[model samples]
Target chain A: MSELRTRMSAAIGTAPVEATRRGAERLAELRRRAETDYPPMGEMRDLARAIRLHTLANLHRYLSEFCESAQRAGTRVHLAADAAEANSIVESILRAAGARTVVKSKSMLTEEIGLNHALDGFRVTETDLGEFIVQIAGDRPSHIIAPVMHRTRQEIGRLFADVLGVAYTDDPPQLNDIARSHLRRRFLEADAGITGANFAVASTGSVVLVTNEGNGRMCTSLPPVHIALVGIERLVPSPAELAVLLEVLARSATGQRLSVYTTVVTGPRRPDEEDGPVETHVVLVDNGRSRVLASEDAEILACIRCGACLNVCPVYREVGGHAYGGVYPGPVGAVLQPALGVGSADLPFASSLCGACREACPVRIDIPRLLVGLRHRLVDRSSFSWLGLGLEAYSRVASNPTAWRLFLSLGSFGLRTAARDGWIGRLPFHASAWTAHRDLPGPGAPPFRVWWRNRNR
Target chain B: MSRLSEFLARIGTARLPSARPEVRAPQLDATDLVSLFIRRLEEVDGVVHRTDPVEVVAGLARRLGTDRYLSWDPDRLPVPGLVAELETLGIERHTGPGREEVPLGVTGADAGLAESGTVVLIAGPGRPRHPSLLPEVHVALLRVDLLHRSLTHWMLEHPQALSEGSGLIMITGPSRTADIEQQLNLGVHGPREVHVVLVGA
Candidate 1:
C-alpha cells in the first residue's frame, strides 16, 4: 500500500466518529450563516483574489515598502531565506532579551519551522485553547483552523485530568475555564509571546491577526517582547486592501462577519504606553515561497488559510487531516505541499477532483486545475514507471483505429467472462486493485464498434 | 548581499498582471446606522444598552456588583465627567494593566463598525489594551456618530487610524471558542461578556 493510503486508513480507523460529525455539522452551520450575513459574497471574493494576486505579483515592491515602514514604526524586521535562518534569528532575539518563558498564539508557520524544538531550554506554552490542549497532549494539530477537531470532549477531560492533576469532567465550558485560568497566569508571567499574522499591511507596517478567542490579543499585548513569524506572502499593500481580505477571511474560515478579535499591531509600545510589548520583531520567512512564486501554481500562494476547502472536501471528510501528513491539510495542502517541495509526489493525486474546494474558496483559487497541473508535473519528472509505460503504450494504440478496436474487443471479452450477474465482483491479478475497493461494471457483450455496426444492419 | 536584498532579488522583477480590483461598499441607510449597529452586535452574542451617557456609566457601575474595575483614562472616554460618575457610584477604576481580578473593564471606542457590530479600540498612552481584554466583562462606550457602515468604509475615511497607536483591535463580540468537540464555549481566554453602551442613543 502507498504511504498515504496506509496513513489514511489508520486515521479513519482511529479518529473519533462523533467528534468528526460534530465538527462537520458546526462547519456546515457556519457556512450557512455566512451566506446570509455577507450578501455580496461573490464580489468580495473577486476583490480578495485580485488583491492577493496583485500583492504576490508585486511582492518585492510591497515587501520592501513593508520593511521600511515597519522599521520607521519602531519594529525590527528580519528577513529569513529559509527555515533554519528564520529559527536562528528568532533564537537570537529571545537570547538577547533573556526570555525564558514564552507564550505562543496559534501560528502554523512556527509549526512548519519547528520553532519549539529549537528553543530546547526555554519554556514554551501554546496559549490558544485548542493549541494548548494539543501541546500538553504532545500531538500535532489535525486541522488548520480548529486544531483539536479530532479529539472528543471526554478525551480532553481525561487529558486535563492526567496532565494538570485536575478532576475529570466531560463538560466543555468547565474544561474551557480550567484552561482559561491556567493560561491566564502564563499570559501575565510569560517573558515573551510569538504569533502569526493573518495579514500584514505594507502601507501602515501593521500585522493583522484574526481570532475568535482573545489569545492573539493576550499574546501580543501582555508580553514584554513580541515576535511575529510572517510568511513573505502574507503582505497586503495597504489597509484598504487589508479590509477587503478581512471581509472574506472570517466569513470563509468560520462563517462570521468578523472574528471576535481582529488586531492590527504596528510596532512596539510607545514609551508613554502602559500596556503592550516593549519590543516588537517581525520575521519575514521566505522558506521556499519564491520558488512557488516562480511556478505555474503560484496562485496557491493566494490562499488565506481559511480551511473552507477542507470543510467541503469529500476526501478530507473520509480520512481527516492527519492522513495528509503535513502542517497544511485538505485540498489546499495537496497542492501547497508539493508547491513548497515538502510533500510526497502522491499528495496531488489524493483528491477526487470534485471542484468543491474551488466553489468554497473565498479567494477563488482554482484548486482542481492546480491539482491536475501538479499531477502532470509529477508524471513528467518520473523517468520510468508502470503508469508511464502503460500510458505511452495506450496512447499509441488509441491513435490507431485497428489497434484500438482489437484492444477494446480483447478487453471486453476478458471483462464479459469475469462478470457475475453483470458485475465484476473481483478480477484476477493487478486489476484486483480496483475490485478491492469497489466492484467494476461489466462491459457489453458486443464491443461499442461492433454494436454500432450491428445497429445499422 | 544583505539578507533583504537577497530575498528581493530571488523574487525577481517579472512583468506580472497588475489590475487592482475595486470593492463597492454596500448601500446602507445612514440615518438608521445606530439600529443596524445594535442588531449586528446582538447577532454575535454581544449586548447593546441604549441610555444617556452619564446614566449609562452610572448604571454600568451599579450593575457591575464589584467596587473595582479596569478602564481607560476618563478624559479619553466619550462621556464627559465619567470619572465623577464612577466616583459617585463608588467604583474604583484601575487604568493601568495587571488587574486580572477586576470583573468589569470599560473603555471608549475609537469607532464602531455597523456592518459587523465591531468596536475599534486603539492602544495609546492613556488608552491601554488591557481594559478591553483582561476583565471578565468588557463594556465599551461608543458614540452614535462614530459608527460606520463597515471596515472598508471606516478605513477609507480614517486611514491614519492604523498609524496613530502601536496597535488597534476591532472586537465584534466576546471571546469564544468551539475547539472541544466543536461545542461553543465563551470566555476561553478573554472576557466572556461584551456590552456596548451607545452613549448618544
Candidate 2:
C-alpha cells in the first residue's frame, strides 16, 4: 500500500492527464452513442456475454476446430504453453523468413508476453503513431488505445527532436506527419509484420483486426511474412457473432459507430492475389490464459478489450494507467493481473470497488466481485497483513448491531481533534496514510441507532 | 504432454447453457435504402453520387486532381463512358499492379453496407487490392442493387462472402488516425478520399 501510494503521489500534477480525462469523456460519449447506435444496449450486452460464456465452456473444441480450419486455410498454427515458447516461435519465424526488421501494430498480447524485450537482436518498430512516440521516448503504453495519452505535446516534441533529429514542434499534424513519413519507409522495407487479433473465428479461419489508423492494414499487407500472436481466449464462434462484438467494440472504445477499418485476413495471399503477405503464421499463446480458464474467476476470459472499464473508472482516471503497474491496467487489469503473477496481488486492491467498471463492461464480468474474491484469496495464500486482520475484525463487528453502534460512537470521540465542519483534516495512527493524499469525512453525526432512539423520544 | 493435449486435459468439454437467447437487433428501420445509404455514407465524410447518369463523379473527380487513373476491370465499371471521360479530362489511366504511382484509384465494391456506410471488397480478377489501397484518391463505383442493409443481414445471408478471399475489408471512412494527441488526421496510409458513385441497376 505504501509503494502504491508513493507511485500514485509521484504521478500527480507532473502528469498532464488531458488524454485520460478525454478518454473518460470518450467513454461517456460511448454510452450515449451505444444507446443510439446499438439501440437496445442492455440486450446486446446480455447476448454478448452469453456468447462468450458458451464459447469459453467449449473452448477446447472450438480451439481444435480453429486450428483445423486455419490449417485448411493454409495458415500454420503454433501453440505456446508459455511466454518463452511464444517468443522463441516468433523469433524462429522471423529467422526462417530471414527477417531483420519487423513493423508491429499495437498489441497488448505481445506486451503481455514481453515479446519486444525478447526480440533483442531484431529491429522492431511500432507502426502506430502513439506507439512510435512511446518507443522513441523509452516508455511503455499508459493507455491501451492511446498509448502516449499521459505525455504533453511539448514532451513528445522534445523526444522526437532528440531521438529522430527533427525540429521540435508540438503541432499534432506535424508530429503525425513526421511519424507518417518515417513509418512509410519502414513499412516498405520491413521483412515481417506482427499484429494481434481483435477476434478469431473458429468456424472460419479468419482473423479480424479493427483499427482507426489503418496501420494494421499496412503491417499485414506491405510485409512479406505476417505473424499474428493471439491470446487463446479471444475467440468466438463465427462471423455472425463477430458482428455483435464489433458493434459494441467501436462504440465502447472510441464512441464511433464502427472504426475506420475492420479487416478480415483469412490467410496468406492466394494463388493470384497481387497484394498481402506471402506466408502467414498464427501463434496461439496461452501464457496464463489456460490457468485463467480453469480458475473459479474464469468469467474474466470473456473480455473484448474495448477499454470501456478503464475509461470510466475514477481510480484509473486520477492515478492513470501507469499506477496499476501491469501490462493490462484499470479494472480489468486489477482483476486479471493477480491470476498471472503472485507479485501482482497489490493490483486488485487498487480499485475502490466502486462498481463503475462492472457497469461499463460490455460483457458484465462483475469486476468488483472478482476484486473482493482476490482479496479473500490473498488472505488464504499470503502471510499476515493489517488489512486482513482489520477487515476480519470489522466484519465481525459490522454484523453485530450492538458492537457496531458502540464502535461508531467510540470512533467519533477518538477522531475529535481531526474533526471540524464534518470532515477529517488529518487522522492519527497509521490510518493517517489515507489523509496524506486525500481528506476523509469525519464521523459527523451520532450513530444512527442513537439518532433513531432520540427521534423516538 | 503436448501443450494442446495438456490444455485439453485441463479443460474438459463442459457444455455451457445453449446460447441461443433471442437477442433481436433489428436495425433495418429504413424503408428507403438509397437515402439511408447515402446519409450514412455522407456522415462518414464519404461522397455519394446518387443523381442520374452517374456523371456527378466527374464533379467529385475535379477536387481529387486526377492526373493519372488506375482502376479495376473495365467490364465491372458501373460509370458508363468513365474511361472516355478520363481520357477527355487529359488524365492518364494505368492498370498494372499493386503499389503503383497513380494518385486516383477506381474500383467496384462487391457490396456496400447502408447501416455503417461501409464498402465490402472481395479480391478477384482485375481487382488487384492495390487500386483501393495504394492510391491517394479512391473512387468506388457501386451498383445500387449491391447495397446491403447491415452486417447482420450480410452474415445471415452470405456468411462465406468474406472468408473465400485472401483478404476482405469493410472500409467505412477514409484512412484516418487520432494517434498524436488525439487529433484526427486523414490519409495516413490508405486512400485519403473515399468517393462512391452509386449507379442505377
Candidate 3:
C-alpha cells in the first residue's frame, strides 16, 4: 500500500466518523441555504469564474500593478518564490520589528509554509477560535473552513481544561467565552498580527479578508505591525471584480450572503488614524503556484478556498479530510496537492469522478476533468504499473472477437463457480478485495450476447 | 531581474478576452429598499430600529441595561447632537484608547447595503475601529440616503471609498463561529449583538 493509503486507513480507524458526518451535513444545510438565499447564484458564479480566469490569465500584469499600487499606498510588498523564502521573509520582518508575541487569524498560506513551526522562539498564537483550538491540541486541521470538524465538543472542552486550566464544559457558547477572554488579552498584548488575504484588489492595492468571527478584523487592526501572506493567485483587478467574488465566497463557503466581516485593508494605518497596523507588509508567495499555473490543471487556482466541494464529496464524507494527507483536502486538494507537487501519486485516483465537486465549485472548476487529466499524465510518466499492464492485456483481448468471447466465457465460468445463491460473496486472490465490501452478481448462464441472439430469433 | 520581476516573468501572459464580464447590481425596487434591508438585517440576527437615531440609541442603551457606551466622535456621527442626546439621557460616553468593560459601541456607517444587510465602516482618526469591534454589543447610526442595493452597486457608485481610508470593513451581522462541532456560537471575539439605527427611514 502507498503512504497515502496507510495514513487514510489510520485516519478512518481513529477519526470519529460521526463528527465528520455531522459536519458534512451542517455544511450541506448551509450550502442549500446559501443557494436559496442568493437567487442569482448561477449568474454570480459565472461572473466569479470569469473574473478569476481573467485575473489568472493576466496575472503578470495584475501582480505588477498590485505591487506598485501597494507600495504607493505605503504597503511594502515582497515576492517570495517558494515556501522557505516566504517563511524567511516573515521571520526577518518579525525580527526587524522586535516582535515578541504574534496573534494570527486563520491563514491556509501560513499553514502551507509552516510559519508557526519556523517562528519557534516567538510566542505565536492563533486567534481564530478553530485555529486556536488546533494550536492548543498540537493537531493538524482536518477541514479547511472548520479546522476542528473531526473533534467533538467534549474533546475541545477537555483540551481547554487541560491547556488553559479552565473547568471542563462541552457547552459551545461558554467555550466561546473562554476563548474570547483568553485570546482578547493576546490580541491586546501581541506585537504583530498575521493573516491571509481572501482577495487582493490590484487597482487600489488592498487586501480583502472575509470571516464570520471577526478575528480577521482583530488581527489586522489590533497589532502595530501586520503581515499578510497572500498566494499569487489571490488577486482581482478592482473592487468591482472583488464585489463579484465576495458575493459568491461566503455563500459558497458557509451559505451566508456575506460573512460577518468583510474587511479591505488598503495599507498600513494612515498617520492621522488612531488605530490599525502602523507597518503593513504584503508577502506574495508563489510556492509552486507558478508550477500549478503552468500545468494542465491551472484552473484549480480559480478555487476561492470555499471548501464546498469537501462537504458534497461522498468520498470525503466517508473518510474525512485527514485521509487526503495535505493542508487542503477533499476534491480540491486531490488535484491541488499534486499540481502543487506535494501529494502522493494516487491522490487523483482517490475520487469517484461523480463531478459533484465541479457542481459545488463556485468557480466551476472542472475537477473531474482535471483528475482524469492528472491520471493520464501519471500513466504517461510511469514506466510500469499493474493498471497499465491490465489495460494493455484487456485491449489485446477486447480488439479480437474470438479472444474477447473466450475471455468473457472464462470470467463468467470463474464467477459462476464462486457464486452462492446467485451472488459471489467472496472470491480468491485480489478480486476478494471488491467482495470484501460488497457482493457481486454472478454472470448469467446464457450470457448477454446469447440472450440477445435468442431474443432476436 | 529583481525577485518581483522574476516572479512575474514566470507567470507569462495569455490571450486576453476582448471584453471582461460585468456584474449586475441586485434588483431592488426603490420603495421597498428600507424594508428589504430591515428584513435581511433581521435574518442575520442583526436588530434594526426604525426611528430617530437619538431615541434608537437611548432605547438600545436602556434595553441593554447599560448607562455607559463607546462611540465615534460626535461630529463623525450622521445624527447631529447624538452625544448631547446620550448625555441628556444620563448615558455616559467613554472615550480614549482601550475599550475595557464597554458593553455597547455606537458609530456612523459610511453606507448601508440593502441586499445583504451590510454596513460599510471606514477607519479614521476619530472613527476608531474598535468601538464597533471590541464591545460586546454594537450599534450603528445609518441615514436612509446612504443605503445601496448591494456590494456591487456600492462599489460601482463609490469607487473612492476603497482608497480614501486606510481600511474599510463591511459588517453584515455580529461576530459568529461554527468551529466547535459546526455549532455556531456568536460573539467569539467581536460584538455578539449588532444594531443598525436607520435615521429618517
Candidate 4:
C-alpha cells in the first residue's frame, strides 16, 4: 500500500493530458457515429457478450477445434501451459529456422511472458512505433492500445533525438517517417516475425490481427517464418463470431469504422501463394487464462483488449497507466493483476468503483464487481492487520450503545486542540492518511443515535 | 493426462456448464449498397471511383500514375487485356516482392464490404499479397456484385471460405497510425492511399 500510494501520488503531474483528451474526444465521436454507422450498438454488444460467454463456457472445445482446423490448414499448433513454456516454444521455432533477426508486431502476451528477455542471441525489432519507443526506453507498455500514451510528443522527440541520433521533431508525421525508415530495414532483414491475435476463429483456423499500422501485415508477410502467439481465451467459435468481435473491437479501441488492416490468416503461405510466410506456427498460451476461465470472475475473459474501459476510467485518467505497475493498466489491469496474481494486491483498491469501466466495456464485464470481489478476498481472507485490529475494537464499541457514546465523547474531547472553525485542518497520527487530501469536520453534528431520538420527539 | 486433456477436464469441473448459443449479428439494409460502400469508404479517407470495366482500366491508367506499377497476375486482372492495356499505356508491371520503394500497386477484391467499405483480398496464384501492400497507393478493382451487406453476412454465407487455406487481408482504408499523441498519420509502413475502382456501374 505504501508503494502504491507513492506511485499514485507521483502520477499527479505525469498523467497523459493530451493523449487522454484526444482519446475522450474520439470515443464520443465513435459513439455518435456508431448509431448511424452500425446497428444499435447496445444490441450489438449483447450479441458480442453472448458470443464471448459461449466461447469461454466451451473454451476447451473451441481451442481444440482451432488447433485441429489450423493444423489442417497447414499451421503447426503448440500448446504452452505457462509463460515459460510459451517463450521456449517461440525460441525453439526461431532456433529451428536459424533466425538471427526477428521482427515482431505489438503483442501484450509476449510482454506478459518476457519473451524479449530470453532471446539473447537474436536481434529482435518491435515494428510498431509505440512499441518501438517503449523497447528503446527499456520500459513496458503503459497503455494496452497506445503503448506510449503517457509520453508527450516533445518527450518522444527528445527520446528519438537522444537514441536514434536523428533530428528531433514533435511533428507526428515526421516521427512516423523516422520510425518507418528505421523499421523498414528490420522488416526486410528479419528471418522470422511474431504477432498477437485480436481474435482466433476456431472453426475457420484463422488468426486475425486488427491493427491500424500495417506492421501486422509486414510481420505476417515479409518474413520466411511467422509465429503467432495467441491467448487461449482469444478463440471464437466461428467466422461469424469473429465478424461480431471485429465490428466492436476497432470501434471500441480507437473509434475507427474499421482498423486499417484486419490481417486474417488461416495458415502459412499456401502452395500457390507467393508472398506470405513459408512456415507458420500457432502457439496457444494459457498463461493463467485457464484459471480465470474457471473462476467466478470469468466475465473478465470476455475482454477483447479494446481499451475502451481505459478511456472512460476516472482514476486512470488521473493517475495514468504506469501507476498500475503491470503489463496491463487501467480498469482492465486492476482486475487482471489480482486474478492472475501478477502485480500488487492493492490494484483492486485503485479504482473509484464508478462502473464507468463496465459501461465502456464492449463485452460488458462487471469490472467494479470484480474489483469489489478482489477487495473482499484481500481484507476478509487475510490475517489481521492494524486496520483489522482497529475494526475489531470498533465493532465491540459499536455493539454497545453506552461504550459507543463514551468513545465518541472521549474522541471529541481529545480533539479540542486540533479543532478550528468546526473543522480539523489535519488529522493526527495514522488517520492523517485520510486528511492528507481532505479536511475532516470536527463532530459537526450530534451522533446518529442522538439525532434520531431528538427528531422522533 | 496431457496438458490439453487436463485443461478440458478442469473446464468440465468448473461452474455450471453452459451451452454455446448461436450468435447472429443484426443486419443493416442499405437500399443502395454501392452508394453505401462509397460513403463509408469516403468517411475512412479511402477514395472510390465508379465506372464501367473499360473505364475501370482506362481511369486507373489516367488518374493513377503509371510508375513502378504492379498488378495481380493476368488471371486475377478484371479484364483479359488489362495487363496488356496497362503495358500499352507504358505502365511498368513487375512481379515478386519488388524493392521497398513501391510507388503504386493494383489488385482486384474477392469481396467488398458495404458496411465498412472493406476490400477482401485472398492470396492465390495470380493475386499475391505483396502488391496490395508495400506500395504507397493501392488500387483495388472491386466488382459490383461481390459487395456484401456486412462482414457478418459474408462470413455466414461463406464459413468455409476462411479455412480455404489462403492469406486473406481485409482492408478498410490505407495503412494508418494514431499511436503518436493520437494524431493519425496515414500510410505508415503500408500503403498510404487506397483507391477502390468499382469495375461495373
Candidate 5:
C-alpha cells in the first residue's frame, strides 16, 4: 500500500506553479473567448440535457437507423460490443488499407480501451498538442480534458527538445508552431485517420465532431480510409437533435460560443471532391455500457464527455485527473468507469459525494445519486470482497437506531483505549490508507452517547 | 470472437431490465428553448445578426472590404442597388464558375436558424458545393425569419431535409484549428473568412 502511494506521488510531482499557472491562464483566456463567441451557458445546458436524454431513450433505434443509412451511403458500419472488439475491428480495417502509419486526435474512449498500445503493427501518433506532449513524456494524462494539465511549461520545453530534436523554449507560441510543423506532415501522409465520435446522428447517418483544432477535419478527410470509434450511447435521432448537443458541448468543454470547427460528415467524399476521404467506417463500441443501458443505469449514457464535472470538483482540483488512474476522472469518471466495466472499485470511492459535479454538468446528470447507486451495487453484489462486505455490515447496523447505538458505544471504548501519548496515530492496516496523510483526533474522555444515556436516565 | 459474439447477442436480446421508474418530463420553457438553439449554433462558431436585410448587406461589404462580388444573379438579391454599389466599390462580379477560377463566392442561404445563427445552404447547379467549402472567402445571404427556435422545431418542420447522401456540411463558422499547442489557426483547410449577409425582416 505504501509502495502504491509512493509510486503515485513520484509519478505526480508537484505541478510547476509558474508553468501550470500559465497553462491555466491560457485555458481561462480561451474559455473567455468561447463564452463570448458561443451562446448563453444556461440555455445551452438545458438543450444539451434534452438532446442527450432523447438520444439515450431511443438509442437502439437510432443506432440501427444510423447503421442502415451509413451502409447505403457507401460506408461500412461495424458494431463492437466491447473495447477489445472495437480495437480489433479498427486494426483489421487499417491492415486491409495497408496503413503503415496512422494519425489520431485525443479520444478518452480510445484511451480507456488502451487502443494505442493495441496498435502493435502500426505507428500511431496522437496529434492533439496536449496528447502529443503526454505521449512524448511517456506518461498518462492526469486530467480528462487537458491530458498533461499537471506538466509545467519548462517540462514541456524539455520534452520537445529531447523528442522532436528541437531547441526547447518555455514560450507557448513557439512550442505551438513546433508541434504544428511536426504534426502537419503526419496529417497529410498517414494512410488512415482514426477519431472518436462526438455525436452520431441515426437520422442522417452522420457523425458530428466539435473540435477547436482543425486536426479532426483533416484526420477524417485527408486520409483515404476514415474510422470512428464511437460508444453505442453516442447516437442521436436526427440532425435537429445534433444541433441541440453542439450548443452545450462547446461551452461546457471550453466555454466557446461554438467550437471553431464543427464537421458533419455523412459518408465518404463524393467522386467530384478533390480532398475528402474515400471510405468511412463507424465502429459502435458497447464495451460494458449496453449492460448499463439495459439496467437502471441507462442515464450514464447521457454523458457528452465535456469534462465540466472535473473542473468544478474539489477532489479533482486537488488531486488532478491522473490520480484517478483511468482514462476518465472526476464525477463523470467515477460513475462511468464502473459502468463501462473498465477498472476496479477504488475509482467509485474516489469522491466526497458533495454534488458539485452534478451541478456543473451541462446535462444535469445526478452523478452523486448515480455514485450512491453504484455503491449499492458494489456493496450488494459483494463485488469488492472483505472491504465491501464490511461496509455492507456497517450500513445494516447504521440503518437501525438501537444497533447503531450499541455498536458506537463498543467502538468508542476501543477508540478510547487506542488513544495513547495524547495522540491517536497509525491506524490498523485497513485504515492506514487514511492515517498516512493526517492523524485522527483522539476520542473524548466519555462518549457523547454515554452522556446522553445518563442524562435521559 | 465467439465470446464477443455471445456477449453481443446477449446485449441484443437483453430487454430493458432497468429497475429505474419512469420520470415525469420536466417543464421546459421558451427561454430554455431559445438558449438551447443559440448555444448549439454558437458552439459550431456561427455568427448571429439582428439587423435588417439592407444593413446586413452593408455589414457584408464592410466585412469583406467592399471587394468584387461573384454571384449568380443580381435580381435575386434583396437590395438590387447593392450589386452595382459593390461593383462600384471594385468588388469583381461573376456567376458560378469552376472552383479553381472562383476565389470569392457569394450565394443565398436556404434558411437562417436563429438558435445557433446557422444559415443552411444546399448545393445545386447555380451554387457549386466547392465554393461553399473551398474558396478563400465564402459569403452566404441569410434571411431572418428562417432562424429556428430549436433543432426539434427544425426537424418537426423539415423532417429529413438535412440528410445528403454524398456531402452534407452544416457549417457554423470559418474553418479553424487548435492543433498546434491549442493555438487557434483560422482557415486551415477551408475558407479563412465566412461573411454572412442577413436579408429579410
Candidate 6:
C-alpha cells in the first residue's frame, strides 16, 4: 500500500469508535431538527421523489434533449459505459491536451474509478478542501460530502506542514490561507482541469457546479482543457428543473441558503474571452449505473449525491465511510456500491433495514425497498449458497402452519439445550460474525403459537 | 460515436418497469420556494441581498473598488443617465470590444430566476459567450421584475430560451471550488468576483 493508503486505513480503523459517537450525535441533531425546525423533510422528500420519478420514467427523452441542447451550446460530450472506459476517454483527452499536471475538483466518479491513481504517470492535484486534504495524505475520502471528516484539525495541520513545507497551525484561517497559496500556483501552472458535475442540463448543455470555495471555477477555467466526469442520471431536462434540484440539495445537505458559489458552464470559453478554459469535454460515466437503472430497483439513480442518508444511517453512523469499503458509504453506498461494483451478495447485507435513510433522503428514495430488492438479486446469483438454501427450505415449511410450528418447536428445543444462560455465546459457522459484536437471544422454551393456541382453547 | 448515443444505449438497458410506488408528492408554497433558492447559496458561505435592481449594481460597484467597467449592453443602466454619471469613472460600454482587456464585465440579464438565485445571461448578437466567462470580474444586470419564485415558472416564461442557441449562463456567485486540499480559493478559473446588479423599473 502507498504511505497515504496505509495511514488512511490505520486512521480509518480507529475512526469507527469516534465516528460512532459523532454519527450518533449528528443523527440526534438531525432528528431534533426534523422534529422542531424542519418538520416537513418527509414532505419535501416526497416532492423530490416525484420530480425524480418524472425525470427517470422518461429519461431517454430528457437525456436526448439535454444532449441536443448541450451540443448546440458547443460542448463535446462523451459517454462511457463503465468506469474504465470513462477513465480511458478522460486520459486520452488529457494526453491530447498535452497536460502533465491536472488540478481537480471533488468528483466521486473519479474516486470510484481510481482516476488519480490511473494518472500516476502524470501529476494530478485535488482542489476541493476536503478532497485536497485527503489527496495530499494519499487517502481515499472517508465521507461522501466531507472527505476529511475523519481527521482532526491538529492532524491536518501536521500533514500540510510536513507535505507542503508550510507552517503548521490548527487554526482554520491559517490553514485556509496556506491551502489557498499552494493551490494558486497550481491553478496557473496546470494544463488541464477536471471536476464532477452536480447536474447536466440536457436542454441547454450546461454543467452545474455547486461549491462553497471558488476552486471549481479555477479548475474549470484556468486550464486550456476542462473535463467533467458526470454520472449518466445527473441530467435534468431544462435549467428550470436544474434550478429546483439546486434549491433542495443545499438545504437538505448542509441547511444553507446556497453553496458559496454556483457556476453554470456551457461548453468552452469563446474566442473573445480571456480567462476560461479553451476546451471543455464532458464524460458521462455509466460505470454500472446503467445496469442499476435497468433493474426494477432503479430509483437509486435519483440520488443527488447528498450525504443526509449517511448522517442518519445507524450502521453508517457507527462505522463511518471507510468501513463501507467503497467510494460511497452509508445507506446509499450499501445499495449503490454493490450495484456499481460487482453483483455480490455480501455488500447489500451492510444495511440494518431501519429506514432512517429513506426518512432523511431529500429525493425520497425508498432505500430499504431497494436494499430488499438487492437481497433478492444476491439470492438469485449462482454463487449464493447459504441464503438461497435457507430461503428455499423456508418456503417448504412456511406453506403449512402446522409444519412450521412443529419445525420451530423442535428447533427451539435444540437451541434451548445449546443456550448458555440467556444467550447463545457463539455459532459454529456463518452466524459467527454476528456474535462477534453482540450476543444472540436464546429461543424461548414454549413456542408462541402453541402457547397462544392452548390459552385460547 | 456521440456521448448522447452511448448514454441512450445505457439508459435503454437500465430501464425497468415499475410495479408500485408508495411515496406521495408534497404540497409546495411560496416560502418553500424562497427558502430553497436562498439555502443553496447560503450553505457555501454566500450572502443574499434583496434591494432595488438599480441600487444592486451601485452597491456591487462600491464593493468592487471602482465604477469603471465594460458591459455588453449599451442601455444597461436602469435609468439612461446612470451610465453617463458613471462614465466619468471610465465605465465604457462594449458591443464586442476586447473583453480580456477589461477588469470588470457588465452584461444585461436575460432573466433573474428566484429558484436558484441565478441571473441568466442570453448571449445574442455581437456578444461572444466566452467574454462573460473569462473576465477577472463579472457584473450582471438582473431585472427585479423578471424574478420568478420557481425554475418551472422561469422555464414556462421563456419556452424557447435554451433552444435559442445563445449562451445562457445561470451564475449564482463568483466562480469557486474547494477541491485542492479542500481549501476555498477565489478567482481560480472564471471570474475572481461575480456581482449581480438587480435592476428594477
Instruction: Pick out the ten consecutive residues of candidate 1 chain A with the lowest summed lDDT.
Output: A13-22
Alpha-carbon DockQ of candidate 5:
0.19
Models ranked on lDDT = 3, 1, 4, 2, 6, 5
In Å, residue A275's CA in model 4 sits off its true spot by 1.5
Ranking by TM-score: 3, 1, 4, 2, 6, 5
Q: In candidate 2, which residue ranges exceed 4 Å CA deviation? A: A383-427, A434-457, B1-3, B10-28, B51-66, B76-81, B95-100
Cα error, candidate 5, residue A73 (Å): 2.0
Q: Using lDDT as the measure, name the better of candidate 2 and candidate 3.
A: 3
TM-score of chain A of each: 0.94, 0.89, 0.95, 0.93, 0.83, 0.83
lDDT winner: 3
Model 4 regions lying over 4 Å from their true place:
A15-37, A386-389, A444-457, B1-17, B52-66, B96-99
Query: How far off is residue A47 in model 2, in Å?
Result: 1.7
Q: Which scores greater on DockQ, model 5 or model 6?
A: 6
Compared with the true structure, what per-residue lDDT tens digits does model 1 show for residues A204-226?
89998998999999999999999
Candidate 1 stretches with Cα past 4 Å from truth are: A395-409, A416-423, A440-456, B13-16, B27-31, B53-64, B95-98
The digit string of per-residue lDDT tens for model 1 on B1-201 reads 266787798895333466766656655445578888899999989999986655655665567777777888888888888777777767777644449878888899999998899999999988999999998888899988899989888987887999999999999999999999878898988889999999877
DockQ, all models: 0.72, 0.53, 0.68, 0.64, 0.19, 0.23
Residue A312 accuracy (lDDT) in model 2: 85
lDDT of each: 0.88, 0.79, 0.89, 0.82, 0.67, 0.68
TM per prediction: 0.95, 0.90, 0.95, 0.94, 0.73, 0.75
lDDT for A208 (candidate 4): 91
Per-residue alpha-carbon lDDT of model 5 for A337-451, expressed as tens digits?
7877765565666678998888767788989888888888777786458876788999999999999988988888777777776567878977877788887887876667667
Stretches of model 3 off by over 4 angstroms after superposition? A10-15, A416-423, A441-457, B14-19, B27-31, B63-66
Could you tell me which 10 consecutive residues in candidate 3 chain A have the lowest summed lDDT?
A9-18
User: lDDT tens string, model 3, A1-457?
Assistant: 7888787767664556558867987887898888876677888898889989888888888899999999999999998999999999999999999999999999999999999999998999998898999999998898889898999999999999999999999999999999999999999999999999999999999999988998999999999999999999999999888998998888888888888999889999887777899999999999999878766878899899999999999888888888888799899999999999886878998899999999999999999999999999988898879987998999999999999999988888888898998999998888888998999998887899999999999
